[model samples]
Target: MVHVGRPRERVGITRRSLFGGVAGVGATALLAACGTSTAPSAPSAGSRSADAGGGPSRVVALSTGHLDHCLALGIVPVGLAVAVSEATDSRGIPDYIKQAFGDRYDLDSIQVVGQRMSPDLEKVAGLKPDLILSNKRADKGLTEKLTGIARTVQTNGGSEQFKADLKIVAEAFGKAADGERLLADYEGRARAWGARRGTPGTFSLVRGKGDQYLYFGTRALASIVGTDAGLTRPAAQQFDEAASRTLSLEQVGLLDADWVFYSFPGNSGDFTEAPLWKKLPAVAEGRAFRVDVDPWFLNASTVAADRVLADMQRFMST
Candidate 1:
């Protein structure tokens, strides 16, 4: 069961469950540094205004996952969707947000929205947001409709896009200085980690259930590690687009990496129990690792990225 510090909020009857039921397993011990026990802080109340710098008036975040970046730069939204579920265990949303706003804000306060699939347009329109912040994966039709009601800004959901997105959001809210500082700090940490590990090692990034898909050779975080962290991808799979391409379990052996840093459905049980996953060379040799999905890949927030780098350092050092 997912453990929450507080009670759940009521919203639409649908009541979507976050990553509940997923066993923390081998990765649990590694995530202690990344998980937040409290909500992150919101931007100062008077700091953000339509006339502050003549920016967009009403702001709505369709991508609730990236909320951490907005909050870090002091950009609060009229609406947000929560991703916490019973499976999350000890990791709550970032403590900065929860401590700042208390219970006044939660995922339900923001109009419920979805990505890739159709979101509740009527409900979103009712919220009457002035601007919408969404990821590239959001449904194109839904974004178009939302634009009719408010201005829309799209962010690429690549690995490095998280840092870039934070800067863009901060600039949109007149917090460019804050965004830059945060990025520099994160980049510095990443560089330090990279310098310590000499001689690149073979690596692969994977996700999903039953059929595992490998991620490599793209501009995302995986590529960042391979290029910046001194890691190398398998010679055969070293294509220009491997980072973005998804592969099947049968192809897992083709990766032939010295280490595998991948994501799994947080709801699944222990990795050792899964027969198909057990067959992986990385997993068998304890070279495979599971990362928190929200912060590592799905969510692109400033705080989340920092947590990701810390986690990566721990994994690499071990």
Candidate 2:
């Protein structure tokens, strides 16, 4: 679950979820700065919303999928777990969210509870949200700990998890009707975009982590959304796993397809200097382009999916 911010073209940042720890505001600092609550922070997912009748509710989201689902549905979380992924910033609001829903809502001001992988439970306790949203990918004991403090519900994963998460969260806030509409709208938009793109072609998602590169499979967020938008993938890269495949620099040829999108851990640096990069057919044809990994790579939310589809639309139009 990753939330993505705005995209700055040509900026390279790896969106793969691999790291020792996430950087976040400490509990002590958050308490000193954001106030504390002696009471339980929130209710479990099955509980009803404490928000005003017919108005938006406050949510505490543990995963990027939860955060983006609520935000796309117009329910800004009171506090959200930030990620070290290139998709989000220090505040955890991805640049794409700012660009897509900036006028509909102001997520930038939302409080940061902790990092997604290693949330500062103390800081989340201080936020005092009425509800908490998490998913199954959390470490074994962590979800139970979250439920102890608040009403937490685990969202499922897979290609359709984005829609499923919205349904769960929308019903929590008495926005079930709206959630259905959002899903319909997404399906309609995806279908229309697919029709517009017309031609079928293979897409390759590449991640550069120093000398060894990783190729995304069917389960990666962006790849899932792209496939839904009628984009095909290289047969060799298609697999049921969500994890990526790491290959040495000499194996760059394996990532070739009709189109290839590359994301780097920070900046691509002078990657073109690598001998294998030029051998890829997409590079020679200029079909391989650099993209911001935040919104395009670890993508799992409706907002990021929209951004990805919009990008494909632009590319297809050309």
Name the weakest run of 10 consecutive residues (lDDT summed) in model 1.
Answer: 12-21
What is the alpha-carbon lDDT of model 2 when measured against the actual structure?
0.63
Model 2 misplaced regions, further than 4 Å: 1-56, 157-160, 210-212, 267-270
Root-mean-square deviation of candidate 1: 8.6
Q: Pick the candidate with the highest TM-score.
A: 2
Over 1-318, each residue of candidate 2 has an lDDT whose tens digit, in order, gives 222222122111111110001123233432222122221112122212333473334467887677767654445576788777645567777665655445444455567877887788987777665577877878879988887777776777544467677788778777676667666655566665676668878888888765556788887777776777788889878886555888666777788798888877655445666778887888888887666676677657665665666555545444
Q: Write the per-residue lDDT of candidate 1 for residues 1-318, one digit (tens) a residue.
A: 111111133211110011111233234443333232322222333333422566654566655445666644444565544454332323234343343233433433334444324556665566666677776776777667777877777777656676678767777677676667656655554565566676667776666543444455545554554455555677655666534566654555655577777766644334436566677677788887877655555545556555555556667666
RMSD of each: 8.6, 12.5
lDDT (C-alpha) at residue 47 in model 2: 16
> Can you tell me which runs of candidate 1 are displaced by over 4 Å?
1-57, 81-108, 114-117, 135-141, 209-215, 246-248, 266-284
lDDT for each of the candidates? 0.53, 0.63
